[model samples]
Target chain A: MNEVLTLKNVTKSFHQKTAVDDISFTIGKGEVVAILGPNGAGKTTTISMILGLFKPSAGEVRIFNHLPQEKQVREKIGTMLQEVSVMPGLKVQEILELIRSYYPHPLPMSELISLTGLTGEELKTRAEKLSGGQKRRLSFALALAGNPELIIFDEPTVGMDISSRSRFWQTVDSFAAQGKTIIFSTHYLQEADDVADRILLFKDGTIVADGTPAQIKSQIAKPSVSFIVDPETSLEKLYLHTEIDDIYRKNNRVYVQSSNTDRVLELIFQEKLAVRDIQIERGKLEEVYEELTRGTKEAV
Target chain B: MKIFQMQCKMEIVRVLRNRYFVFWSLVMPILFYYIFTNVVNTNPQDEAAWQAHYLMSMTVFSVMGSSMMTLGIRMVQERLQGWSTFMRITPLSDSVYFAAQMVGQSVIHLFSITIIFIAGALINNIALTAIEWVMSGLWILLGSLPFLAIGTLIGLMKKVETAAGVSNVLYMVLAVSGGLWMPLEIMPKVMQNVAQWLPSYHYGNGVWEIVRGGAPEWKNILLLVTYLVLFMVLSKYIRRKQEVA
Candidate 1:
């Protein structure tokens, strides 16, 4: 099947500053793709272009084989923008009703009220009276209200407590389970690591890295080792000092990194190092993100 | 039609919930009308001309307050609060959104005018013929168009808070200049000239004159229509700037 969402060579600029440059990718139906990047990394800008909130300076974006400029195409998509600008006078229930009137087949209000986790008193209160987290939840509720096939969240869980964020991911997972397509944008790498099928990282207004969580981890500079040793034989000296790339010690725990592992293991056995505990450190998505942003050839 | 109705209903409900509606629509118009009526006494017995003058001023004042202050403030607030963003981006088209707003605000403005007109007749003892009353209502509706455009533009141009304040000042200034409170015949020439330029003046005069058994002239109607179209065009231009960028 054609990907549920696609952008081919999309570039968007604000004034003279290029916010999103020549970026292209696609996400299939039922797949959760995370757009991961730091501040000003064009993640939000990229999503805005997809939503048709802003016209792209270059290139085209399509959601479900239709441009957002088409009204019929918009009905197939739901969006929670980075900024929540809902009317303050509207209560959560009232807001839901208002949105419900627009789309012919909206999600049941009660179902959505619960899916968003809004409680009794909160549901009746005006939007301005809502707490920040409640506001975010309500915004998401509006996005989901129309029961569109595709939902795009722009940094949805920011400032939310861990529990709320976790609940949010569960909600997303359930949506994905039902074969709904999702595109999530967030700076929280851990969240992306947990939920994303594919994580696309943008830096300098262009996408620099795109891969699955496990695949991205493989790009880390070097493997690491950490252990507590009783006898202080310099690992560098014992291993011919050539395999050691870097060493850090604190609280009587030693951490070391190197590309070579054979010499290090030989030294560990020969010295009979009284190792309390040993762990081979596999690089995390965070480490790979750092490496990608460190003037990697891919970023350029 | 579905989108239009939905938008209109939403605008009506949203306006009903606004704090500014409490102050502008409910509180301020009645207060201003009561105070202005108190300052002048139109003898009921023989000086029917003076009574006519009093009734006209009061009715026109009601229209002035409802259309300018009420509509302008609400539009500006909707613009600033990002309420327009939701409506603006909707597939129904921005013109549909504006149509809904106009319909919603017209209903609201009419409601306020009715209540205030009743209070004027019963409580303030302003006299009017049934024909005159119907004519006044018609003129009031016609007078509302320019302010509707002005409010729309202001809402589109200014952020919410600034729009509210700007609209309030503009309303009051136009209310006074439009001769809603006093007789333009007795006012200084410059102020009269300024009043002539304001659409509120035509609405106030047309409604007030119609209420006093005078003819509703076409000049004010023409001027009001001209100003309304001009403001609508100006707002459309401003929106075009957003569209291109």
Candidate 2:
């Protein structure tokens, strides 16, 4: 991988509770990697170490092939923290202009404003008076203002409106299309599934699952086949017709789970029963994530 | 250097916007140079006595304004607002941060003191030797350290409100102790002794001596320099600890 950032054997602790314990990961250039974890699962700690906000106990972080504290390294990275937005006292133009002076080649104010989903009149308004979703959009705008090669957004969407959340994912996808590296963390699983080129599900102080969503889905052991049938069809007759492992019904929709999908399909063909909309897998990442991380990964 | 200059300009712009500090910048020197000095001249019609009184009072005001309160309280305010941390993420060095603050504060204080000195001399109809006049104006800057050091110490040790409260109380103590607000000779014998023990008194004493065109006095001048070193080291130490916490 053409990596922009590398972490090796990283461990960080506050007193005795190991915040990050022997965790290692790398983010390649132009890769949109979603860091998925519950709250206090060492996601923020890892990000802080990468940003040089705090030092790690056991390992090191290499940003642009240099330590994060180095000015040369920091200059290449744009940080829009969870606390990115400033006070209402600052007009949008004034804040952008001030932040722009920090970098060598920043995105033009017009471009950044557009990228963040803000327009002419809203850009003139004070930041503090903006709605929560508006503030989040502006936060991302400021992060992109520097035109940095790498952006790290922690918990990018925690309290966003559904429409705004959808927009946020679209922005992430757009950033990826621009070929910039992003290390974004969120408990919002569906967002991860949508945009992440790769996903690392954090558990305790380490990653429990590391791969593309398909690879993780394949890692899930129980891929069951299900069937729905008419209520008039006898349960015993249905059981006799197919090798169904389990059967259940809700609103006259017959549901079945079978270990042998091929035999189940063959039995369905043989029975000539009505089958409506067979969902091959659960579309929810939350279910898969919980099953992967629970009891299997060490917590701290 | 460019970064320092940028930070300096930004800080100055922000500070100039504050109503209270802006009000003080214009008001304090005139209060000291004209009113307080004129009030002290028991023989106001005597041009020589008026010259002595005006020069001494204004020197006291200028040194205190430029060094102690401006650097200390203002820095504390900036730290409280998290502006200092905002500035810290930049490529600017710690030394640059401190140096720019010193230079900027002195620059603003320069205007207030300069106006007061020129107006005081002209109004009193008194003349000073060309070197003495120039030196007295320069003394406001030269004597900036001890009080600035004091201000920095306050900034390092305090958060917003605590720093403000501490600075006001300490400025009062220093003003009294240094004989800036009153004559040390008029202070109680105990206060006179305690006054001699403080760097503020030494700071004020150094400038007061030069403006009077007296022979160069080395002891108080040396003591003020000592205070400067002590304060810089102490404040640096405190700020370093604050970063860790």
Candidate 3:
């Protein structure tokens, strides 16, 4: 795999607080990696360092074998930051033209309009006058204007509506299919689970886990058997087994969390507990994300 | 070169679309020129020389407002709104971006100066030799450097609200103290002393001398240069501090 980005022990500190601790990772070409974390988990800080907005306090970041701040690297990289703001007075079309002019080889206007789903009327309107959704679409279009080899998005879907959000992912899907290296940080766990080839789970300025979605979920998230039990039945006998990792109740259903659901099932039957509607719940990405990010010790 | 042109073109478009620029730079100066010279009729001496002098004053007034208010406020707003951050990641270098901004605002300043000079000619029929007209306009253009530097300093402010407030107060105080609205001769003795130390005064004095059949004094030129250097260095230092923070 061709390496598109590499961070070696890169760290960023602001005043008294260290935002990104010493961390290293390399992303290859055509990989769609999701950086997932709660707010202030150094996600934005890391993205800023990658985009050359902030210099690392220690270590190095290289893109395409060059410093990120170099012009050669900037030409190949495109980004949409968390805040969406365009130049105030120019029409959308004019602003697009200005930004496109900065690149050596820009995407043709027709393709940019088609990909971003910007209407003719919206393009004619002044940028500051556009609705919130229109602004995001325009920002997305600007990110793609350079026809960059590497694209970075920080919270790309924060203010997007349902339809726009789906459209955004669809465009990203097509880009990924075209062998573009994409990196994004998102609060939507489902988006990460569905879209990312690999997840870099971050907590407290460090990567707590990094792997394929299936590998991460299987490694940390435990499967569980959930059942509707009678109110009077005691679940104390089920807890005596060391195989059970946890037990909890929600919506009047008792969930027995363990890696081996069959053993839990047999234990339940042997106890002759009056339980019905029994179902097994596979470990999900959301649970893995929660366990890792919430700093829980339940993961084996 | 092409990128610089595009950036400058878009910046000009942005400033032209601004309502405040239209109001403060164009309309207000013309109105003040008409009211002060014609309505109030305070010359009490050679009306033509007074008209020409006040014309220089209003022209400087307009240029100063655009520099401090339009350029300064827009800079702060752009930085605060994340537009500047977005530009940083692009292939556009920071020097090119800053140059484009300064060039764009200068073009608007030229437009403002031309409009007020034309208004002075029509309203009061104030006429000068071709050399006087050309020289005065050239001096005003060159002498506005200090005010532009001041505008850049205001742009360094973190908050748009604070920048706007500061620009307004600075613009008004400088204009009044420098005798752009009225002559320093009739003002209090202390104000006359205060005007000598201000860039606005030197900026107007250069043009005033040009329209009065004399070249700009070396002292006026030298003082304006000093102010320009001082403000630019101050702005650069503040910018370095901001980047560190």
* TM-score against native, each model: 0.88, 0.78, 0.96
Tens digits of per-residue lDDT, candidate 2, B108-221, equal 666656766777768676577788767766766677767777888876756667777777777777776778776687779999998887876776676677666674368877
Model 1 CAPRI rating: acceptable
CA lDDT of A249 in candidate 1?
80
Please identify model 3 stretches exceeding 4 Å from their true place: A230-242, A295-300
| Candidate numbers sorted by TM-score from highest down | 3, 1, 2
Q: What is the Å distance of residue A254 in model 1 from its true position?
A: 7.5
Q: How far is candidate 1 from the true structure (C-alpha RMSD, Å)?
A: 3.7
DockQ for all models, in order? 0.46, 0.18, 0.87
TM-score of 1: 0.88
Q: State the TM-score for model 3.
A: 0.96
Model 2, A88-194: lDDT tens digits are 34567766776667677888987787677787777878766777777778777777878888888888887778887787777767877898999888888887888
lDDT winner between candidates 1 and 2: 1
- Could you give the candidate ranking by DockQ, starting with the highest? 3, 1, 2
Superposed model 2: Cα runs more than 4 Å off: A85-99, A116-142, A157-173, A221-283, A290-300, B28-89, B92-95, B115-130, B240-245
